[model samples]
Target: MSARTTPSPARTAAFLTAYDALLARWPVQVEHLTVRTPHGTTRINACGPSDGRPLVLLHGGGATSTMWFANVAAWTAAGHRVLAPDLIGDPGRSVHDGAPLAGVPGLLGWLDAVLDQLGLPRADFCGHSYGGWIALEYALHAPARVGRLALLDPTQCFAGFRPDYLLHALPLFLPRRTAARARAYLDWEAGDGPRPDPGWREVYALGYADFPATRVVTGPRPGLDRLRSLTTPTLALFAEHSRTHHAPRVAEAARRALPEATVAVLPGLSHHHLPMAGAAEINARLTGFLAAPRG
Candidate 1:
């Protein structure tokens, strides 16, 4: 509530500059939009053919819409209109009023308002990490508004978070040593992939230092029966080496629970590398899922 912390102006400026540099690498026609919700405002980046099937992309916590840079081109090439919204209460340009969203209910309300303003009654959803959890919640809360769901290493949706994750993350809280610690954590997640680009890495660290930290309310964990009840076409990907949870267990549970869904544990991948290590493979899988005719 009341923004856990406010980013300093200087740090915000630096973050924005680095964000722009990362965005510049991907050249695509985009329409910037602002949607008004009852509680706050959301910023959305729209791309692809105006008449194509609507596909909403949601980025993970601590990341913004720009996180989809690697996947957008593939989605657009598959003839789907893509909309990436910066989750409010994160480091993005979206702004909220007095308090951050109060868990799932607030999140749904904000999303509904944004969709309404975009003139979309229903759309396919693609989300990564925390955003994936949000998409799963949306599918359950407002089933009719979701055509299908694609979750990329979503956290705390299929399984509980591993306790050791916090222990490994403790170094990130230190002020003076945060950057190095953050980079180490990210590197661990990235596995064998080369380090992230300089500009992107710099912005990530700056955002980590400056962005207002907010509570991650992992609302009620739905039972397997609950997930099984949903009929929406679903695709859930779990990283084989994810530090968030036991990926193999989660993948198995997902497959057993959601009989109609396609679930897989990606080999040699982790949460953060979902957008990098096997980006093209993930994009192809997603595009194929979206393109298939629903039974």
Candidate 2:
């Protein structure tokens, strides 16, 4: 499916300007890379020692690879080589010049190609929101390629979206969607607590209205059997105040389906604030789970 069309030059510049300012806050050296995949040209932001344990990060919808800013510092400090990518067809620099990756296979295919080109045979995987769903599917689809899996408040993995979420987010899909509405919708989701950085928030809203083919390609939810049979050690973390669905309900389903996985909810977190909130705790849980040796 085609997206809203290429963003205007002015709008694109605005996003980059805001994005660059936020990126300057990264604590360590960061390398910007463009890799070829069957799906399109993928933009990746990488840091940490080149020989450290490889860890790939997939950002939630409307959040480009830049979303990892909070966790990348701690993760890299722990000696993880972090690779965060702008999902093809989402906002940021990735270009969807090839045929649309129509189904789940295509989504996994894109990631597969990315790693192949990067010369990584296997690596740990972590994703947030929609990206989490993709990471889960990828781990299940290609278990051997994945060393471990970490999910952050993923949607459509263990439970369907809440009706209220769709109702509030409906304006984002309409042709009439505007930057103001996008900003307001985000404000609604964030409620009283922390939200994105002011500069990055502007960038996200511009991309949300200007970026094309976003929030598309949500394939059917992963099968329960596949989930139950998953052998890859997993971490399923949810937002306590997530508006997407009942957090406890999803956590219960995760326990039932992937009984061996580490599942918990971060207190005071809402859907949008998930990755940015409780950075120290989030970093600890993620680093600890991923760093643990397999039994």
Candidate 3:
């Protein structure tokens, strides 16, 4: 399926320039591992220590592990090992040639293979947006392997219906000149400086170009019953300015779904910027939650 609209030349050029600069700054370490899934060889960026408690970080759709750039250092510094893997089909280092595990089961199996390959019996799981959905799926399917779970502005609530993407891309769909200006506006507001790394831009671009299916892989609606069944200690972080207008509703839904879950809303942040905007808070909460004694 084609994108609703083609990216304008100016927008494309701007994106390319930003991407080129990003690659020069943050050079990620890439690893190739094969999973049992039919998707074939999967590539992941394995950062931080291998000896520390394995903390797997998953990024939202249209984003790569680079999204965790700001959080990795803090997480690692706290003595917890961190693993930021590019979702298989996304534009990160991971490759998806054949059919990928689309929904919850597919995601769980893919993650299981990653853990098995790394010789990790279990680890703390944290995901942002789409990653959050996958993280929840893993916890639900393999509760024994997930010591703790953190969901950052995850989707699939409200019966799997959300308009966040439309809102985020609305500016891009404006008039060409207007779109260019809007894009520039975002770049400026986001700090036009080079990204922490260059490869991140490339990875993100690749996902944008190759992984259109990501838009359709929000996963199934676990509903309230499934959410209530999750026994893993969970933390749900919601951005104050989430594109999902029903932020309060979603948060309330999550709280009700996982009655035992720790729910908190970070003020003065949007969906895309939460990973960075709430880095310190997220790190602190995650550290405490993960470090806490588990039954």
Candidate 4:
């Protein structure tokens, strides 16, 4: 599709500048990698022992892999190899030069290629929002590969978006999405609750304004049969003040579907604040999940 093109040089430079500033806060050595996939060249921020337990992190929509700066440190310190890749089309370093993912299967194939390129047979998967959906999909698709699953206020898994959240987020999804509008929408999502880092906030807004998204492929949520049939261990962390879906409702559905999975509602956080503003609690919970032996 025409949407799978490179971003303007100026846009790339500005977005990278802000993205890197937060990335610098990762607190550990990092390696930048470019993996060639059937979809396109996937850019990854990799760190920790090469032989460490492999963990693949998927970033939320425009937030990019750089959004993991807060959570990576804790994981890396615990000796887990973390590879956070910017999704192919959504913006950031990954250039969607190849064909747009044919479908959700196409996206999973792209991830499979990325993992193969990185030399991971299987690994732990952690995702936030859109990223969580991907991880959940891939886990269900190939349960044999994922050791553990962590979802951070993930959207569209067990429940759909709340109308109020969609109403506030409508501008960012429209044809003329801009940084100004994105900033307003983000602020509204945060509300009187905790705000994101000023640096992260800047990059988050710029991602919407500058990067003209080519294709965003979000399919219907996994069917209840697939959710119930899931064999991999899962942890679903919902934001208490999320402007999106009701946390408890989704958590209840998640529990009903995956009775053995751990589900909890984090206090005083919004959906947009995930994997960032709620790092402390999120990191602790994540470390515990990751450190646990696979059953």
Estimate the TM-score of every prediction: 0.92, 0.96, 0.76, 0.96
Query: Tens digits of per-residue lDDT for model 3 on 34-152?
Result: 45445545655555556888888888776766677667766777777777776676554455555546565666777888888778898999999878888888888999999999999
What RMSD value applies to candidate 4? 1.3
Q: Which consecutive 10 residues in model 2 have the weakest lDDT in total?
A: 1-10
Clashing pairs in 3: 22-197, 22-198, 23-198, 23-199, 24-198, 26-197, 91-207
**Residue 91, candidate 4: alpha-carbon lDDT:** 71
The most accurate candidate by TM-score is 4
Which residue pairs in candidate 4 collide? Answer: none
lDDT per residue as tens, model 4, 48-100: 89889998999888888888888888998888999999999887888888877
Error of 1 at 2 (Å): 6.8
* Candidate 1: regions farther than 4 A off: 1-6, 173-177
lDDT of each: 0.80, 0.85, 0.65, 0.87
How many backbone clashes does every candidate have? 0, 2, 7, 0
At residue 1, give the lDDT of candidate 4. Answer: 33
Which of the two candidates, 2 or 3, achieves a greater lDDT against the reference?
2
Q: What does candidate 1's lDDT look like per residue over 135-209, in tens digits?
A: 998998889999989999998788888888878766776556455666677777665644565665665676776
Least well predicted 10-residue stretch by lDDT in candidate 4: 1-10
